[model samples]
Target: MGTKGQLVTDPRAAALASKAWPYEEARKLLKRYPEGKPARNGQPAPIIFETGYGPSGLPHIGTFNEVLRTTMVRHAFQAMSDAPTRLIEFSDDMDGLRKVPDNVPNQAMLTEHLGKPLSRIPDPFGKFESFAAHNNAMLRDFLDRFGFDYEFISSASQYEAGVFDDALKGVLRHYDAIMGVMLPTLRKERAATYSPILPISPKTGIVLQVPVEVVDADLGTIRFTDSDGEVLTQSVLGGQAKLQWKVDWAMRWVALGVDYEMYGKDLIDSGVQSGKIARVLGGRPPEALIYEMFLDENGEKISKSKGNGLTLEQWLDYGTQESLAFFAYREPKKAKQLHIGVIPRAVDEYFQFRGNYAAQPLEQKLGNPAHHIHNGAVPAANPPVTFGLLLNLVGVLGAGATPAQVRGYLANYVDGEITPELDALIDHALAYNRDFVAPTLVRRKPQGVEVAALERLDRELAPLPAETSAVDLQNIVYAIGNDGGFENLRDWFGALYETLLGSSQGPRMGSFIALYGIDNSRKLIAEALAR
Candidate 1:
């Protein structure tokens, strides 16, 4: 637990900060999964990094975090050496549609198509070919906007193309071994009759979970009792069958020659199971990076099902993609609380890191987060104004203000002319204010004690020189709050935020008021007090 500016330099932090870390790790993985290894089975081998998507719901910020973080590592790997690398974004759309998502349309229709493969189910939105196709397209659209260069492979297409046929045969041949690994994890009843290969019902084309009568691995087929109690045999190839989730994960690593992959902390046990299955199938498992989950402000796990986590769209509305990327850039294994309120601070921190990255030596630069955020091609500098400051300006200016209007206001606050970057920030700030701030504005008049406190604050500010630093004004605000009978600074800050920004929290009052100007601050506070 280290705070900013605190010298809590540990050996682990030092090692991660070292320039040689990425290069050494890349070279090590190259050696571990060498080009001419037996695992490739005479196929051309590329250093593969895989990420899986479950298209049960719309892709959220968490999904973006996984892809962006993995891409950062991939970019680092490329910076290390010229060994060809590929990022495979896999979609598990062939899995059965056990339950319909509550967010989508046409719920009654989805209920009728339950138990079918997600790819086979009709799209609830009625715009795409299938439900899986719609979600996969959404995933592609977002990733493409980010300029990500990667291969997208869907499980439905892979199964139809017989890409996993060899893996399936291997699983069937060693069914007993896989069950030995999986059975212990299941309850007694489930362990009694669990099959690694779940064959789709030949009659209805629905994925079946019935008992397997026989595994004729020699013929590359399985006889399974379907939902209707009719026994049937299907070739475990070309979309006839799909391995269980854990088994599919392990098999994908071997079949695709994936050298590296990462997963959430909740999948730690599942990763172990997959690793065991991979080793059992005579393939070296991919190196793993298990990241802790992102929680909401309330400390509950962020999930698409729970709809508690902030979506990627919401963050982008308030901040840049780079800021969101920076949030995922550091200490991935540590639990991070992400919400709409933290956007401006994250944007500011990114600018701070960008400054550090630009000034640091090449050796020292590799350890900085901006290095990874920009994929080692960091910009020379950031905009002059902090996002929080710009946001505060937006709060006061009202969301309806035009970019030209903002440019006019900023011309006086900042020393130099408003550059193109500042112009862009103004646009983002106005959008952020409209989406997150303006609608929450408090418009009631302050009475009695609140009125007196505002007047006192306004009187104190009325005589201050325009050149007064933000720090000095901050002290004055604190004293006014204490003199106004607030228990502590936190409560006073809360009151100020509620009366001023119409939010429970906001940017530092001193910097905000200072940038807003002395006379303007007094007038604004007076307006609120007398509303």
Candidate 2:
């Protein structure tokens, strides 16, 4: 609480503590526990911030979004309050696997394990003890890579270890009350068969979904008919049974005393239903931030099982992790198309925000996405050039552009030696151009006066020394376009981009020539004329 308590004295921190979304979330918690730490059993109870992961499929960008955003809120709370806080990265691994994910291998093996608890199924990947274990390990690895401070809790382990014993009992005691909250929300057919408790079959090891025939609140047991038409009595406690997802969500809130959590907008109804059940169990529901879901390029909701959106690895391939975080920080309530195409913009904006952070005023600095992305420790170094500019450079230089070659051209524009940040940007630009840009390039053949314009611009550039400034070269190009009998200057520049770069859009002509060189521009014009 050293500098944390001093947030009021530091105007920058003070500004952020009042304005930022994370700060707003922090204020909610502050209101919940006004004394900073609520007392339980005469001891200060640590506020719990929870994020849930279902290990049915590999962790995707949506998974990262929830955890990272939660971490940001957790950091905000730590910066403004002296109360101890704990982040629970809860894995719902004990839940049954309903279907095989399209992204995973060995689908035939996975099909055999349908309806069984994920932790009990054999790992199709053949790496970990079970499928859920493999996914849970991957989730941990990614979160660890980001240096997230949190405790990983497995639902299977929590149940088997009796960590949720009392909570399970509470569910049994309030079974009818919990069902009262959920039944009306389901379809008539589903409502007739729905039960809050799902008992894991001792014989088949599958989670049974049949309706509960009886509930014994005193004995903590449930009676249900099996698929075999035999009635079985199962203890609601221990790992023998688990509640339905909505009910389970509430049980966790009561058991762990979760103070704050965030969910996608799609889960609004579930959150509402769960809150009702939590109240029935005599527990207050956590404060929630409902964020919009990410969509694929087709505008369909991104699914982890379908694997339709950008994966974490795919995004990191073309952008820095900070860029991804920046993307998450912006407009959390607004839907965004999460795809490979969006990476370049996100990267450039991250660089722009980071570069401007130190020079920004106290209030602006606090409001900048870079401030929260880096957790108030924004890096001093910025990329020498934007990712968009670098992509254009790569396109003009072609696929043969090596890192050193790109750096040599960049040296002409950037004043200092290439920092590692710039160096990484160069690599990402090259990779993006090779994969996405190069395949789509189609140089338009010069028609009529377009040929004359290219020739005149080529000649105008021929006299300019390599030392000539981009501005001067730009002026020369502008004069050529103006005198070339083109009705509009935009058409002239469009001709230049399409004829020379094989793309409809390009960097500034002067900057492109400076980087691509005057001789190369001449050669490009010559090639276009020949076509």
lDDT of each: 0.80, 0.86
lDDT of 1 at 227: 83
Where does model 1 exceed 4 Å of error? 1-44, 213-215, 398-404, 415-420, 434-514, 525-531
**In model 2, which runs have C-alpha deviations exceeding 4 angstroms?**
1-9, 16-18, 41-43, 213-215, 303-307, 411-413, 446-456, 475-489, 529-531
| Best-fitting candidate, scored by TM-score | 2
TM for candidate 1 is 0.83
lDDT of 2: 0.86
Tens digits of lDDT, candidate 2, 1-531 = 115443244753574446778888877987887666668898778989999999987777888889899988888888777778899999999999998888788999999889999999999889999999999999999889888889999999999888888888888888778888998899999998899989888888889888985467767788988878888888867798888999999999989999999999999999999999999999999998999989999999887558687888888888888899999999898999999999988998888889999987665676789988888899887775678778887887887788999998888777878888789888889888998998898888998789898888877778878778778888988988888888898988899889889888777788788776778778999999999
lDDT (Cα, tens digit) per residue for candidate 1, span 96-165 = 9999888889999999988889999999999999999999999898789888888999999999898888
Query: 495 in model 2: Cα distance from truth in Å?
Result: 2.8
Candidate 2, run of 10 with poorest lDDT: 1-10
What shift in Å separates residue 321 of candidate 1 from its native position after superposition? Answer: 0.8
lDDT of 1 at 382: 73
